[model samples]
Target: MSPRRIVSIYLPHFAIQRWRRRRFGPQTPSEPDPIVLAREGHHGPVIHGMNAAAVKLGIEHGARVTDMKTLVPHLQVEDAMLEADVRDLRMLSGWARRWCPWVRVDGKDGLLMDSAGADHLWGGEAAMLADIRQSFGKAGLTARAAVAPTIGAAWALARYSAEPQEICAEGEIAEALSLLPVAALRIDQDTITLLKRLGLKTIGALAAVPRASLARRFRHHLALDANPPKRLDLAMGAIPELLDAKLPDPPLRALRKLAEPIEDIDNYAQVLGVLLPDLAEQMDQRGLGARRLALTGFRVDGKTSTVEAATSTASRSTAHFAKLFESHLERLDCGFGFDAMMLEALVTEPLPQSQHSLSGKIEDGIDLPHLIDRLAARLSPEAVLRIVPQDSHIPERAERLIFAGSNTDAAWPAHTRLRPLRLLDRPEEAEVLYAVPEGPPAQMIWRRRTHRIVKSEGPERIAPEWWREKSQTRLRDYYRVEDSEGRRYWIYREGVPDDGRGGAPRWFVQGLDA
Candidate 1:
């Protein structure tokens, strides 16, 4: 069970070390230019990545910002902060969970983790890759790491080895993946262009071909097994079956660490109300509850401020997460003063424990979930909404609004006619006036006002899910009419009654029945 190390890291100048720490901050400017990030492509701003002085001036990575400014005419470019490089790769995956709690990220500039059994608590695997490259060289960042026992041989020794850390031994993932390339078996680019037009270019030439013609010429099933103990147990570890289809990260977090640097926001709301009663007693001993939480403070000058809060269901209430962090604690930017706070539930559920009604009340409708958690903590979770039910028989695609306290049990569609209590968020193109395009319209103008119909019933037709979509729409009919100032509309007509598509069926109105 303990034989699966995995590290990987690799940042390859994650967007020029985040554009040289946002234009030189944690210092390093002795010779700067030659940057490049560009992005708008379709044949315009291409060069999506560069630096190491635009790769020593060859400037090639989908190169183009108009031919790299006609070949490094002092390059520099910029434009690709890629959402601040994915918010500094999720704050370096929350600072690599202080070293391994199975981190993963790995793409838009790598990070993989699973330092199995946690790299001997930071001392071996080359002293946890020299203390994670000295904490990414004090965060100006430029990591390269590799430790292997297979996350595809530590992502092929962290981007094909030049050793900023390498460690593979344990039947050496097929002699450290036989000198690399076959894109190190992370496969597909059409299997590395059909293994480079079949000269099988390395994973030791697809381990010398023939494992039933490498699974009938690349119908691949991991590491071309030409038998070296079945390609060393199918090439050591091509992502431990993608870390067993992911989802292990959240351990419901809490952290605190203050002792001093607090800068009163009521001492950060008295340390988040004494850390929400031990995070609501760890979500009430795991019957779980939280539905998105976050808090994170970390400040004393190295910036970190998160506040997040969302809920409509799962709730292990600590005065409902201190009224969901008192509506974003006055937008926390405690800058030079936080010294760590943390929280993190980031979504949880299962909350089971609610049977009490011998006249104590609560068969659902508890003050409308505390007035929708105080209007989603003072307005904004898409400003509150929530309809749900949508399999679509098209009454505006049969319901779905979502966002106000989400956790839907659904159940609302049972119409034997009469639906309009207030729908319209779109649907108001009326004008009709007809004398018989199949009866009932008698005066409709709407919004520019004309209405007369004094009482009409409906055509109520609907149709159009045509298995959800490929576009054809038209068949509607509906009508509930009632005008001459008695209001009540709901309209609809669209088409059908001579469905030969096109001309005169239009109408629309959709809702209003007070």
Candidate 2:
């Protein structure tokens, strides 16, 4: 393995996954596709929406969240999740390591592997890369490769080679990379523009300039130094490739248009005639249909509104698109005028080949996901979620509400004790008129209501999860108390009784029964 030949992969715009689900849908009023902007973390980059639609209009990265909204009035921005990006990067790095032992992640989206000696193990570099590409083919991703002298030299060739989107050999590095700008070496943009103004359009052109003179004019003074013996442009092997893929476009596309822009939108019904045939043909060629459709509408002003509707059945017929978009496009405001509309089908999991037996009917039911999508289109996706518990003794941190579409791992933690459904956001305190020394409360006035405890079961003590910050720590004794009215309440008292420093014990209602 040549130690100097280093490989680096870059994922430009790596943060696009989290913002996959937008807030507004086709059933709602017309709106631009908003994105969440997340900070780069260990996982590479989290897609926090810097609305691609707004970005299409020329907003650059790191534009303040509020400023971005003002720049594009309809923009929706969110805090990028740093933690999630790190997790994703770590996973990608693990995948890269499968090809080579010395794999390291460049940034969120880039992976670098020193494939010098390892290429032979997979038959050869190009063949190895083909295998890599084939794996991504199944998973649906795109990649580019290059090879060169040093890791820096190889990186330059890989990023800017005319054949950058594919693999390059070591001997072919200099010729392939000669026409590339110095910025291809992963240098800053400002330096590249300055080099261009100085007539250094290519790496080869920049190599001929005198060191003393070049140093006086620009910061790339080191590139001109003649004393190093080795030339700055002494390129070697072709740099290996790095792959990048955005959302995979499924095989089929469906479109709908309006004859006349109408705010009432009776036109969406009338215009399904022309668009459905083209999509049906695509489904035939691809052998898939309308399991998922991303219905998009472009207004006269070039702003786009999209709604994705799905079906339980993999439908290739015109009726499916009509039924899906009927209610959805109705709410779409013509806003000046809607010029074009397109429906892109995606995530087309297999539909049944034919009717199944009666026993299959017992296992089969109407697609729950199709129903959920309908409900989400009418209501908010966040509204239709399941209660998931976290493994923490702190009442406030024990559970959280998360959107169902997020693919979040909100499983009921095996390490946690049973948590009640009615956890108070804050512990409520009350005056205890009568109580046992160590047993449950005998009589207490809570929420301004006086209650005489008939039966009490408790002493389920829970100590604070002190691994976290001291401010969040708690020591509590829980009790399930049954009062005369047949109402059972789950309550807990905080702080150990003997622990001093004037920390008074407080009582709280933790949860209620179903």
| Clash numbers, per candidate | 2, 36
TM-score for candidate 1, residues paired by index: 0.31
lDDT of 2 by residue, 92-207 (tens): 77777667776666655566676667778888766776776576434333455554445556566556656634455546555666677776655556666766776778776766
lDDT digits (tens) for residues 1-514 of candidate 1: 8877778888877777777678777676534577788889887889878777677778887767988798667777878888888888877776787887778687788888777887778777899888898888788777889887777678777888767778887776777778778665565466577567867677876776666766564343545432232333345653234453244444887889987788667888888888888888878877888878888888888889888887777777788778767868878888779988988797797887666598977667655776787797787767788778886677776777788777677787677777789978889887888686667888988788787887888787777666655565677888888888788888888875667666667888978992
User: Could you tell me the TM-score of candidate 2?
Assistant: 0.48
Please list the residue runs of candidate 1 whose C-alpha ends up more than 4 Å from where it truly belongs after superposition: 1-8, 11-39, 42-107, 111-370, 374-399, 403-435, 438-471, 475-480, 483-489, 496-514
CA-RMSD of model 2: 16.9
Show model 2 residue runs off by greater than 4 Å: 1-252, 255-266, 270-293, 296-324, 333-340, 345-366, 405-410, 413-421, 433-436
Global lDDT for candidate 1?
0.76
